[model samples]
Target: MRLSIISTHKRIQKGDIGEFEKLFRNLYSPLCHYAFRFIKDMDSAEDIVQDLFYNYWKNREKLEITTSLKSYLYQAVRNKCIKTINHQQVKEKYNNVLRLQGQDYDDYSSSNIETEELNQIIESTIDELPDRCKEIFVLSRYEGMKYHEIAQRLSISVKTVEANMGKALKMFRLNLKGYYQISANQ
Candidate 1:
């Protein structure tokens, strides 16, 4: 039960650390980018790729590959990204149930707790953003301005505003991950 890259016939015996390392080095970045396309977060994408490689190495002797190594790696990354998304969705659903049940963990009213924590997370995440991106995001979201309006106010193109807003929302999603599990990501 040894793993082999079927197309290249590159046999991966348990002791072949050099070959394994080479494969990892060759594919890690590309796989991370591929995962990022699905998850929209670099950190989570890298984690997914790294975890895939780790598990691939851990059970090398017990695994079988029916496709090219690259294909297998890509498929694994895609599956893991989808799994992560699904897991996040499930957590979001659970959180929604808690919210609906009116479970209060502190002194604030239910609405106030969610709003305050949400605003805090948004502010902290925005604080970490680049200056221009932060300004654009604040204009579009906090100020309730449309993209075109924000762009005009900042004297930038609407496309620029859209790109910055995308970056900001991506950052927000990444930061909220494992912290808030808000229903919006659902």
Candidate 2:
């Protein structure tokens, strides 16, 4: 499965299936190992490598390799692993904050419990809101979407998003005020 550096580049550029298969066979395991160094999960590492190869193949005609193909593959896997880890971290942090704010736990009477409870109260309150207000609130708060982006996604005007969000907030304040004070004391 050996290919000269120049031949590999030319074969890939020419969309040669044989060379591509040879390249995949040669590179796949090593790239997965490289990804595992960062992510420490075999499945995720394999997925990242597979996606890298798929994208590589998909963009073969337009792809440029200033470095060796091996180097490019390694760099791509490294980047993908980093991105995956970062996204996971952001999600965990967001969940932690949400739980803390929502009163979602027990046993320790710690912030976690308060967050769990608060979360339930908030969800119920949001569910009780009018349909449009609930949608707008979820989009803005839970989805972390900007008002304008929400409007664009829902095919509404920004002003409508603003008005709905305002209504949602007022409803939340009225409904969750007692829960908020109780959680504050905990």
TM-scores for all predictions: 0.51, 0.54
Identify the leading candidate in terms of TM-score: 2
Candidate 1 C-alpha lDDT tens digits along 50-140: 9999998887777777786777888989989999999989877767776787653332356676788878987899899999999998887
- Expressed as tens digits, the lDDT of each residue in 30-114 for candidate 2 is 8888899999999999999899988998998888788777777788888889899999898777668768877433433475567
**CA lDDT of every candidate:** 0.81, 0.85
